[model samples]
Target: MTIADLAGTPAPEAASATARVRTPRLRRYAMTAPTFFAVEYAINPWMDTSTPVDAALAVRQWDALRSTYRTLGHTVEMVEPVAGLPDMVYAANGGLVVDGVAVVARFAYPQRAGEAVAYADWMSSRGFTPHATQYVNEGQGDLLVVGPTILAGYGFRTDLRAHAEIAELTGRRVVSLELVDPRFYHLDTALAVLDDSTVAYYPPAFSDDARAQLRRLFPDAVEVSSADAYVLGLNVVSDGKHVLLPANAVGFAEQIGELGFEPIGIDLSELFKGGGSVKCCTLEVYS
Candidate 1:
């Protein structure tokens, strides 16, 4: 069945009708400018590089997205994009930062491995205690911080061994969730942490065991439609209140609104050719 067919499935009742609303706090983010386009074919399932990406349009869309964050009262830092690194625009993969500590990613692909050093240097210069891991990890692309724990993904671009290294380095509990679908290669693609107590995810992207674990941990999780998931809908950026996602993900946006979040959609269709959306372009830096 298609995602539209699953749209009718009733969402789980929220844990509380009046969930404790937290004030939106200032968020620091890291982003990169999309100045190059080498994605001519699908490296991951999400990209159809053969379709031809409009490089100029991609830059405009990215700029608009950066502007959106600034307009929302957030500080966005930039990491200088290197030549020949087309995928560098997805800044979230550079490193995972939490509580002033950064664990730099050792990318699984050689194409992206150079980004690790640049990100580490940037993080170190910014007063973050940078920790470089020997294991292959894709930074925030596969690691997400929710509440006190780190939700990590493996069985795709990231090595499972990186989980322990990150946990040891950050002293945060790392819960490993295996990604079952190639399209949802990163944890951020399949899951969005809306707040400390809430998350939105696409169940089919994860293994059954992982889904069960997610249910146990986040009972108030919102399940996105398959249609939304197909367009990387759950790959969203959310502060405590506002959620930014792709404009085409109407179903997911509606669901987010119902949960008391202000869902703001921005058109990032051009970048979608590179296998990413809002979350992939944004790396949250926690103080």
Candidate 2:
């Protein structure tokens, strides 16, 4: 289908209405800018930027990472600039579009608090009906939709209250877990749905219960080491059999290649500094 054809479809009906019984699609995904992504400057008190070169390099890295998605056949639409908050420009990060509807997020940071409003406007302008998360939760990075189930991370960026609210909004069973590792504040940092039945994850980031739940849901998950996981770009975006990973991760790219699926890698060093990989920077909505 053409890009115009893809973008021209009307938003799906509200989840509460009977008209909302269509199958959810997962065709395209999006990513945001890496500029102004340094949390140390805006949110992190410990962040000290001793040089301007570091900031310039960070922006360069972010641009390179965003282009990597395009090289993989996935459509990359640049969300316009949001003054002061560069992260806000990547409209995909503000909400999750399941099927054709947009699920708006409740940002945990006060600086990011305005993203939801801007994202809602973006969706509406595109003929999408936006849904909001209950309580406070960062939408793009906190939740992952695998088949019929939504895996949500609770703690740090997303709260339990938001989990319950998401369940109420979509009427889908939200499997919630408390993130044990503070470093990986979001689930994308440690876990990923490779396919409907297969997953790639770092064991140290998941609790016993969460691991059990994962096995029960996806009995075919291929466990990889945290070090390998880092190299694997475990959270890479998937389109049918195609997977996009980080360019620097050679071993992980080779493993994915061995699986009969095409693997494409791009350099994402700048985005990593902001605590996001391929998946975190984008939101995929399919029908």
Candidate 3:
């Protein structure tokens, strides 16, 4: 059943009644400007090099996303975009910082490998102890923090072996899930960690085994629509009480609103050309 069909009161009523139950979390994130964003090569199904991307529009949209985070009282830091890495703007793939320790990203594709080095150095410069990862793990793109667990994704961009590496690096228990859909290649693309104990996901994007795991873990999770999933709706950034997602994901927004979280929609259509949205542009830094 779709989220709307699930037995519940109207979102407006539930939100008004329960919104105060969730505590707002102050977040710190690292973002990269879309200075070098381009669809020059096809890395995922959403990208087609032939479709021209408006460079100016990309910058404007990225600026708006960054501003949105700051406007919500979250700290946003920037890493200087390198000249050759176009996908660098998808900063969540760079590396992940958790509890003051950073695990460097070892990208599965050689096309984006340089991004790992940049993030490792950047985190080290900021006083974080950076740990080099031997296995292929695309940072926060595949590694999501949910309470004490690190929900990792595999079968596409990240290697399953990387899950153990991440667990060893951060001392957080890592649970590996397999992605079956090419369109939803990363965990963040199909699932959003709404809070430490909650999530919203597109079930079809994951393998059956993975879906079972999610159901056992988050029985009350929001199952998003296929329409919203196609628009990269699950690629969201949630700070406990506030969920920020792409403007096109109206249905998913309403679903989260029913959970008493205020959903904030922002436009990142330009970045969508590069197979990313709000969460892709944002990497949480747990300090």
Candidate 4:
């Protein structure tokens, strides 16, 4: 199989290949972009001192974050800088790709206004369809795929309008949750559903109604702490028994191990400043 095969598309061997090369496999993913120079705003454990030093630490964090996933065996791709769009590198947020189709996101931030179009173009070039947002909904990061249904969060990175749109497009039931904090901007920031019957979350970010719904759906899931959420570690991703977490979530790794997942940590502090974690830096194609 070739890289084209992995992307679920065909590429003429002569057009881009010297010979047939083994294709890279794909995985399921939720995505996001880095906030340019946005590192200045990350919630750091050591931020009481000078601003410049804090900013530098944020960069190191981002590098560590990206490196974490790379070590876990993902084919990570970084988008080049687009002037004016600071968080463009978190390409996964521009849209959600189910299979190989792109669901163009309606960014909640006006500063990221043009990203949808640019991302759509990129998707099309890769031989994928660019699906539009239904009700101004952001993609992957805010839409949690649990079993066959999607639990969408509103108020911070998505809206009810967009929530309805996603449900219609994917033919999945989308339930909305109101975001309770600015710092946990999107659902991925506060909640992570590891499997149909398993989930991890940071309680304070959920509204009373949302919390009730979560409990009803995943009563048996392992409840993680807020500090682990800060590292965005429980944003738990799996590659067989190998689970990925943020480097800072060393303690969380222990918990994942107890659950039968071999914890693998990645340093992504710099990328976190733009408000993203392990789930954001990856694009997976689960066939």
lDDT of 3 by residue, 35-54 (tens): 98999899899999999999
- Identify the runs in model 1 with alpha carbons over 4 angstroms from their true place: 1-22
TM-score of each: 0.91, 0.79, 0.94, 0.75
User: Model 4 over residues 86-146: C-alpha lDDT tens digits?
Assistant: 5665655677766455688787667676878877776786678888865676676688777
What is the C-alpha lDDT profile of model 2 across 43-99, one tens digit per residue? 322223442335576666556555545544556665555667745633445877776
Q: Flag the better candidate by lDDT, 1 or 2.
A: 1
Supply candidate 3's per-residue lDDT for 96.
Answer: 83
The per-residue C-alpha lDDT of model 4 at residue 285 equals: 43
Question: How far does residue 10 in candidate 1 sit from its true spot (Å)?
Answer: 24
Instruction: Give me candidate 4's TM-score against the actual structure.
Output: 0.75
Best by lDDT: 3
Looking at model 3, residue 169 earns an lDDT score of 77
Reference-based lDDT, each prediction: 0.84, 0.63, 0.87, 0.62
By TM-score rank, best first, the candidates go 3, 1, 2, 4
Indicate the worst ten consecutive residues by lDDT in candidate 4: 15-24
Q: In candidate 2, residue 232 scores what lDDT? A: 33
TM-score of model number 3: 0.94
lDDT of model 1 at residue 27?
Answer: 91
Tell how far residue 160 is off in model 1, in angstroms: 1.1
